[model samples]
Target: MNAAPADQIRLLDVQAFDVRLQQLAHRRKSLPEHTEIQSLTKDLTQMRDLLVAAQTEESDCAREQTKAEQDVDQVRTRAARDQQRLDSGAVTSPKDLAGLQHEITSLAKRQGDLEDVVLEVMERRESAQERVAELTERVSSVQAKADDAVARRDAACEELDGEAASVAKEREVVAGVVPADLIALYDKLRAQQGGIGAAKLYQRTCQGCRQELAITELAEIRSAAPDTVVRCENCRRILVRTSESGL
Candidate 1:
């Protein structure tokens, strides 16, 4: 496609701008904060799971403790009834009295056992509660860190977006000066070559692919008409040569 010499020169600026924009976009997506936030979020999830497990265990221990205390109360009530019967001399038979006394002793022993179990359950509940507290704190800390990371990532993205917007506006202005056919060809080549369509020719070398061109090819391109748009022989990208290109 035909493009004025000035427009062809401006293609180099467009190429540089596109490269910068691409780099900025990549940096925004791959920021360290982004990765850190993901890692922290995973940790928060695991901590929450641990806290849930601890709470479940604590609740179970509380229920068990309540049942154990109830068992002790029941046993004490039976012992009191046996004592009252003994005091009233309701059991006249010696053997029956002996059996009643034995029952009282067994109830006392059972009550003691239940009390011991209740104590153990209380201790276990305390431990589980402590674990839950620790895990809860950990989750909160991780969440705060994750929030900060997200904020930082967002700020970085916003800055890059602003810069990109400015560059885009400049590119649009430059595009208006180039021919429609040239812009279409550049767009097509960019899509096919990882968003890089134009490159400067430096000292007989195609900067896009870093391949040296033959002397004859270089002379032909250098002597081409002012409206002719040259392309790299190796990479097929628009070749925008300049005095600084040493071509």
Candidate 2:
């Protein structure tokens, strides 16, 4: 394949732009906000789970307290009824009256036990409520951090995308002036050679491979026509000659 000397130089400009676009893409991926967002998202998930668990516990405790208070009320009502019956002489027989008084005493003790249960349930419910509140706040805090990180990542990516778009446009303009056959060859070689299809021959060295051309190779290049397209033997890339080629 052959291209004019000026066309080969323009190919280098296209390569430079391609390299810049690649760097921009790398910067976009490597932004710190990406990792920050990931870590924060994990923490947010865990916090939300804890908040849900705490809310469930609080709800359970509330139901338990209500049931305990109801039991206390029932026991107290029974004890009051039993005392009234004894006081009104409803049980005149000595044995019956004594039995009635004993029954009242047992009812009083039962009411006291039920009241204690209500108090215990109240304490537990209060603790559960506090835990739910704390977890809720923590979840909100973590969620806020995650949102901020995502915003930062988006902003950085937008900036990089803008720059990459501009560089791509410049590459297109530069490549448009080159012959289609030459561009096709460059693209093929670029795909095969790690992003570098053409390189400058400077001071007797192939910049693509960083190797000095042997005496015979230099002799051959020196004898080649000025408009001839030459390739480096070491790296198999198009070698564009310049005044600094030391040939």
Q: Give one clash count per candidate, in the order shown.
A: 0, 0
Question: In terms of TM-score, how similar is model 1 to the real structure?
Answer: 0.94
Task: Give the number of the best model, judged by TM-score.
Answer: 1
Candidate with the greatest lDDT versus the true structure? 2
Give the clashing residue pairs of candidate 1, or none. Answer: none
Q: Whole-model lDDT, candidate 2?
A: 0.89
lDDT of each: 0.88, 0.89
Where in model 1 is the C-alpha error above 4 Å? 245-247
1-247 in candidate 1: lDDT tens per residue? 6778899888878778788888888987888988898899899888899989999999999999899899989999999999999999989999999999999999889989988998999999999999989988888899999999999989988998999889888888887777788888888998899998998888878889899998888888878886788998889999887785655
